[model samples]
Target: MDKTAIKKFAVEARRSLIESIRLKAATLGITADGIQAKLPISTGDVEYYVDEQGGISGHDIVKRQKLVAELKQRARKNDLATAFNDLIEEVAYTWFNRIIAIRFMEVNDYLPSRVRVLSSTENRNIPDILVNVRDVEEALGGFTASEKAIITRAEDTELPKDRDAEYQMLFIKQANALNKNLPYLFETTNDYAELLFTPSYHDGVIQHLITDISEDDFNVAVGGQVEIIGWLYQYYNTEPKNTVISMPKSHKFRDTEIASATQIFTPDWIVKYMVQNSLGKYWIKHLLAVGSLQNESEIAREFNWQYYMPDAKQPDNVQSKIETMDSSLKELEIKQLKMIDPSMGSGHILIYAFDVLMQIYESEGYSRREASESIIKHNLNGLDIDTRAFQLSYFAVMMKARQYNRRALTKITHMNVYDIPGTDDFKLEDFEILLSQLSENSSRLLRHFLQEFTFGNELGSLILEYSSSLTSLREELDALNHNQLSFELIPLLDKVADILNSVELLGQKYQVVITNPPYMGSSRMESHLLKFAKKNYPNSKADLFAMFIERWNKALVSGGYNAMVTMQSWMFLSSFEKMRVNLLGNYTISNLMHMENNVMGIAFGTAVTIVRDYQLPSFIGTYHQIKTADVSGKIPQHLPIADNRFNRTNQANFAKIPG
Candidate 1:
């Protein structure tokens, strides 16, 4: 894909979509105030209500309800934009689904005969069935007529004059089916269901859009989607806020905006460096322990690892260190070796990790199909605060898996990827129940402790177990086990499970942690997020990325590897003295590549630092500085540390210098 062209299209598409939605919203009179109008119910019957009318007049409950009804009626008649959003969302999902299906069919020969039948068909029915929308009514055959009518009305309907309404209905059905069939794609409440309605999507525009982009263009293995979407988000949010009167006030600064403003897609070379040094290094060390590699030099050559090495004067000591290091091969299993990107915006890091992990699995004689499934099921994990990020990441990872095994999605299993908590339906009260079980005698103390508990604790442990159990239960439900009680608990369980998964992410240790953590100063952070960071990570609170550096360390197991590309501020800034001290005290810097500002088309100075989560005395590592300007953005990949263009240094000596 042409990065520049894709980025341009994404920006224009987002602008056009938002404009169309806002115009439709204005026509429908669906303002924030309009949506918040009181219903025809007493205050005692309702939990909350907002008054739009000024002064005491707004307090007239009966009149407010009447006004709300009128607003709703107007919205129903004219508010095509809100419905359009939903249409666009559904269309986007359907488009991606088609892409996945087409790709799967292309490799249908690799699939089981039973599953191949589903993909080989070319009609829309095949795509519909693949996405699980076809026969939706029949699947719920046991329901009452009225209930069935409601379901049918929501999923399948036709409004000849109103294209938008028809599109909305089509999307409702498609989205619901996707949620039912492929839970990974439409996990949780479908947030995109209410954006806008498009009437003419099926009238060639959708085909044109799909034709404009090729399936091969959606490169999940690199940073294609991340770069394109990141640019679109930035352009959308930064556009003039007052250009459209119909734009909801709440839409101006949203979580998506935060994602756009902060996200920077890590370059492919950077991703390679991080994965190679962290995951690659770990594997090589394991090979040495297993007597797979004859010596340190062979290990370095075989793995193409340039980071950790013994001092030229003490090669024997390197052997002794490897012998003394933990020889537990359990951690070295390609299936069990977990790699995570906590700030996984679009999953660029995790996607690249997938590629590296596949190589390791293949090297160990695992077939591509087994390796792909194992990677998705056990090795790869990601979490992003942005819902879009999670969606893209989920799709990207699944798409990558499809490349290896066309039948991968046929297996009823959920990917380990997740979004952060706030986006989900999870509530604080859910945790209250769990905490109460932990300590009924001192609820206050438990609450206080829970508040302070960040990750990698008892709460995290429970969350991991809960998440696994919930996943198993969900699989059972999908397998046609219609236990009423189990079904009833699924929603609550989902909420608690998501909460636990998020918490567990912070608490659990990973074999490799790789990310380009979001870069934003405390000043740019939302007030609540800033306050939380300050409380949780005081030493590294000056910047969000710095805080993640601390969090990443906590998220790693003893001797685990962490690789990150972050702003170079922490290295020399006075405020980061404590962070620097803490990091040096606990971790070994395996390799450092300090690049001059604008080295990789980014305006800020950046450094790729690879660290091991163990503190080892007499550790010798490599460091290099790139000083030359390269407009091509490929120098980092092509240039070797031995190149004179790089100012090389001993990592140990570099760390010894004062901040």
Candidate 2:
């Protein structure tokens, strides 16, 4: 669309997203006052500014003024990425306020109470739900003073002993259900209109459930359960929106480190080509398993069997699960991959994984169901401390998953694998039993169990028998999976998930570990997060990117691959001595593709390097110099597996001009 149209659309969409978030907050009881100081909704923000001379000003003039002001404020800061994270703090603050509100309502009332008009921030249900209850209570205005006290207690305190928790859950669900479906319930996107008009439905239902139930039935909502409401709101509000806000075009600017002037946003076709090539073997296996599936219907049947009915299939249910298993194996051979961009503005690396995994699935002939599960479960993973990057990653996953299952578009919220089997150290009495043994050796058993998880080990039919042994803990386990487990699961899962998640980083030896990590110099790393990293990763030098490399490489088994589009200066910059030694000592440096300009039209030049984990006899630390390929032209030696040595460098300077 035209520029003005783009601005108009962006402004409207951002406003809608913000407003929807605010209204959702209101439903959970966070009043304007609770969030006003933190996130004041901008009402009269200008769309465009005019010069005093009466002429409309160009975007450049406005953008320059803003940038200069920002630059001055950030003059002492070396890390641009850090400045961006400040915005993340604000966004997260707003999100948590809504979370607290939901918790209060959910904890305070299982059944809807008589609606009392509350001041903003009083932690009550939305005015809509309360308005109807208020009207009903008013109609029966002759209640004794004692009854009013009972109503007041009901509104603010824990439920009486006579309430059924299940009914309360249902009531809360119903209340939330309406809030979630507000757009459809009332034919309007106007935020206040939905809040003003929607309370009557909850009035009768809440009154009936609370007054009738017995006391022994109350239960609390699970942690992260409120996330469901947020997920649903996004689903109900689904629409594809895109817009580009204009900023002043850059004048001559040197990357403070690159020391050279170059335009940014280097085309990534080469890096993409190489990664896809490396992923070829993984893709082929995904293709074979999918080929066995008879059709989409068969695939869908298998999917239903796997997720909704994990036990429904007999031993013969290999039709679809086999395809999934095979793909997982091939992907495993690639080693549970985690690609990061240190200077990750948007999560291009993660999105690229999405494309790569999808291709492998499509190649195998699996339906979208199989493809999506494979991508989400097996292949793609990444991390960026950048909150915007985190959101970008999340949004990208939702969009990609939508391709396979439209319903998934609504269901998947956090892109991080929030819950996986061993992620939160699943304490089966079996594990404690195994670990607690003092006989000739419990180490062997622990090793065996762990080995089974690693190196593609499967306990097979034995898992059924062993899993059955844990029946006594079924209720607890069920609660754990549902995110309702005891506080005990937290520290346990943190440890377990950390170890398991770390495995994805360690198991395969990378032939390449590629990235453009955030280019913060050592002087700028200070905040709590940076301090924690320093304390934890003290000996190992870690910038956002370097730490990513360390963790990823540690996860690599051997002979694995690494490739990255990162800041060019990191190659020879003085501060990176430790990183340089780690690279040269351990990896076979085969290629470095230096971009004269930027990677994201931001002010950093990029270098794409291909490194092999194990050095071949003739190729250690050598620059196999090659000509830059045209983006639209034939893909270059993409995977870098072919046997060719164009140049040898026992030690070469990257900063000095390449002859």
Candidate 3:
């Protein structure tokens, strides 16, 4: 469409969308005089129309302008919901590229192809083709010219003989949608068409789609997507099909099973609260002290959040997730606060850290770019036994930094986390290859051999699994691939073992450590991890998180804090007396947040204990004891729970003794 045609259509579409918005708002008793919406008048209720082919018709542009006007008016009136929706529609429609539109549809089940585009109107226009579902049509609407050509060619052919005509028809419909919509957008459509029209293409695309979706849902965060993108390029992988396209690794699709399990996503509201409470005045104070800012009042005005906030839908949430730990910290003067999550599953903490730093930048006057650079350079770090998790953790950390500066995202690179100094390292690429090979073709003889080598040897099991690829290995079995694999299968397994050991030595220094270490009861502990732990702490008994705590105390500087979330059993269990004694003798218990009676909805009781290396002024002791009257009126002795975050003052007959 010419610019004028596009502009005019944009206007009409915008007006129609606005009318729909108005009508909806009226239902909510929000419209002026509670009248039904009419055309030619602008209200905050603007709608967006994306064509069946997914492009904004000329009508959409006009509606967008009107929507903007309505939003400004609404903002003046302080009608926040109306104003916010108006602004969202305006922004989504204005910058709504086909890629992002496709992405939105890909994730949200509610977004129909003809539904008011991207949080615009809730209602939709009925399409001429009720034949295909509106969702499919919407998904197909964004196809390119090459995609269209592929469809035309497919229509002319006697193909997909193994599949039913209805299946073929759906495929053709999808192809046509691509063709109609994706004029200039889809790259390498010709190559993909060749794959899709062929049986190999059908098989390849299906398998690839299943593989990506499954792997992604398992744990692929934004960084995992980056790695996948890089791998696709490195391996010359193709799109699934000409019509049924796969989301790029950069686009996350939680696996079906995992997605259905529970909402693992940290609630944005909860995240906001955490960021607000944790960072608080520390950010403001640090910003002034560092001279990053003269005061806190300049925060929202100077930072230009649009640059830092990637998803416009949740600016406040994003901001909350990443404000500074302490604004009082200066870029030049702030002491480095190193952290390590030994288990480091999917880098949640690291991602949170990024948000914290961004807020710090906001607290100061630093632009998003300046603040991001400083944080990545100085404040963040992570570790994991699983290489995939390690790569993912790194990816998350870098992505967090990149959110502040896209250019930096490009420069972020991946290196094997196990690569340590003065060691002939094992390459992850080699291990990944072994896994792929195992997936492609593995003999029963090989399986039997691996089971023997891996069973009771968790690391070996992990190697066997990784050797099997994401598709072949069961989810629970995937954890075994971290360290132990059959030595015969990957002759360099021993070398990799050496590298892991060296990494442990080299990575002994860190200031703060936090993690949700995997749980293993004494009976259930995998043989390898159990053996390793026993050898390391010959006389002590503890859980995985406690072992890590001991390691962290050894690693930290005198004043550093080790904050942890761990099971409550560690507090009073007689088995952990030795471990407790060692901890109390070596570290000062600073603060504790205990969730008694399972207050946090955590199935297992847990607490956050802050232990510092410096000694406490009082010998509040090696062990804390308390006495309480039971409901039966019997007196019972009470002791400090595992890490002593609980206050002993409230409980009567309590004692604190030195180790």
Candidate 4:
């Protein structure tokens, strides 16, 4: 909850983790230049390299080959420098994520072992899991077969032991054990860590993480929130953001750096305001449509919402237009209502929306556990370009679900959160060859669908133009699943099936589409992204945020709410004139709060705007123009004072004013 402290720890953590991981990589004889040393761990026919800590058997030798292949392939993809640094940063951040997750689990007593993995309950410095591994009975978490073998070796008296090496091996075993539960954070054969998890790192980086941050920061009983991970993620990107800015003007943000350059954490208050007005307002409208709730103020009070503005008295025409709202809300079940944050960086917006959805579900007679599962399974969806962001968001949501349901994590088979897939590595030629075997129009649709996924790392959720084709591909793939196929094609189709599910979610309609979309002007866009926006979104091609404003609108139904926190320049800049005209012509704003510069560490002025997907040209919308600069902790305090300065106007009125 302490932003200053979280930021300080995160910025420093990034530097320390990167340096530590790099040092560990160096010890392993892998460097940006090339692999300088190889310990031949021969397994019959294949030549394999031994790791730094050595003494690993056949499985590790095979995994080490995987790691080497990935590194060499990446170096071929870009330069050696880019690939090396990216691999190091990725591994470092992943470990950072794992440490944070373990601490949270330990504090919450959510670990199945009922043991603290990172720090001892009796002593802050000692890892209880490490100590626990010394005794076979202390391994209450239940280790895998390989891990038990390692444990048996650790207990061997004749084996000469280095305590540091012992601890390193034990911690890796614990990480591997946790992998079955948390595959998202730690894949069983984690390519990044397979070759890099060295004895040097445990002696250096792991201790630094445990000792550096305050214990209370990870303890929920002491006022910590799982949302601290979001702050840490934002802070971690500070250096990358600065690096992007320091680049030459013509330099474009490549795939690896795009997320880092554009992710800005939405302040909680702003997120609440956006969600309260969009999804919150949608539920109220549903209640009104079905005559379940009439008085908006009474509903707001019942919900205990600080930012939900009860609608003001409307003119007769505006009131009549409102009366024509979708009464079909009464026909649909609450679970049918879907909401997504397409640019869900660390899922800050979706996290708040989860709480709101929980209240809505419980009000309708669902238990907390049932409602939590339903929210994750049915109501909430998220998408992001950054895999790291996706993982953090996934962890945050899963942790939140675990807060309500004891068995939520294990029971979850799939979540709607997806990092948009890129087509660069896609085996399209093979899929196409399989498709040539008497497929329906699926082959054509599959081609179009895969084509749309191109540049996904750069364009991300903005790749909405092919949603129709993606849906068709889904149907065809579903049909194909029932039929017998070639063994090779079956595996290939299985991969496509997974991607199909995610892309279909990306393209589907939602009742509420909310996000603080990535903000970068057209001038800064990489050539591929710039070209895509120009071709697909010419009207709103001025900035990435503006393009998202247009894109998410397509992701919503007619009566859905499209809400976002974004740079305020879209409201006035000449470059955005066409975009404004398009919005005014198609949608009606319900609420707009224009804030002064540096509102959320953004230098430019910004606004939180909520617009109805339907057109109500005559409807007067609430607009709060707050000039207070950097209202960091003071937003809620300023709202009441801001009310007197607010204006009610039809957004169409903006068209009459000069650009």
> CA shift at 50, candidate 4, in angstroms?
11
Worst 10 residues of 2 by lDDT: 456-465
C-alpha lDDT (0 to 100) for residue 320 of candidate 4: 76
- Over 381-440, each residue of candidate 3 has an lDDT whose tens digit, in order, gives 554443323433554455455545655533433222331211112223435544544433
What range of 10 consecutive residues in model 1 has the weakest lDDT sum? 458-467
Candidate 4 per-residue C-alpha lDDT over 378-484 given as tens digits, one digit per residue, 9 for 90 to 100: 99999888889988888888888887788886786567887776765455676676577535777776676667766776888887744465555555666664457
Candidates' RMSD to native: 9.2, 19.4, 22.4, 3.5
Q: lDDT of model 1 at residue 508? A: 62
lDDT of 2: 0.37
Any idea what lDDT model 1 has? 0.56
Residues 159-259, candidate 2, lDDT per residue (tens digit)? 54212322232223333332332211212212222221222212332222222221112222232222222222222122211111121223211122111
| Candidate lDDT (C-alpha), each | 0.56, 0.37, 0.39, 0.75
Candidate 1 local Cα displacement, residue 543, angstroms: 0.9
- Sort by TM-score, best first: 4, 1, 3, 2
Off by over 4 Å in 2: 1-274, 277-346, 386-388, 404-516, 527-543, 620-659
Per-residue lDDT of candidate 1, residues 379-477 (tens digit): 888877765667667766765676677666566368878776442122345455444433344345334333433322111111221112234333432
* Candidate 1: residue 533 Cα off by (Å): 3.1
TM-score (C-alpha) between model 2 and the true structure: 0.42
Ranking by lDDT: 4, 1, 3, 2
- Give the clashing pairs for model 4: none
| Deviating ranges (above 4 Å) for candidate 1 | 24-29, 36-177, 187-195, 199-208, 211-216, 219-257, 295-319, 326-331, 423-493, 634-637, 642-652
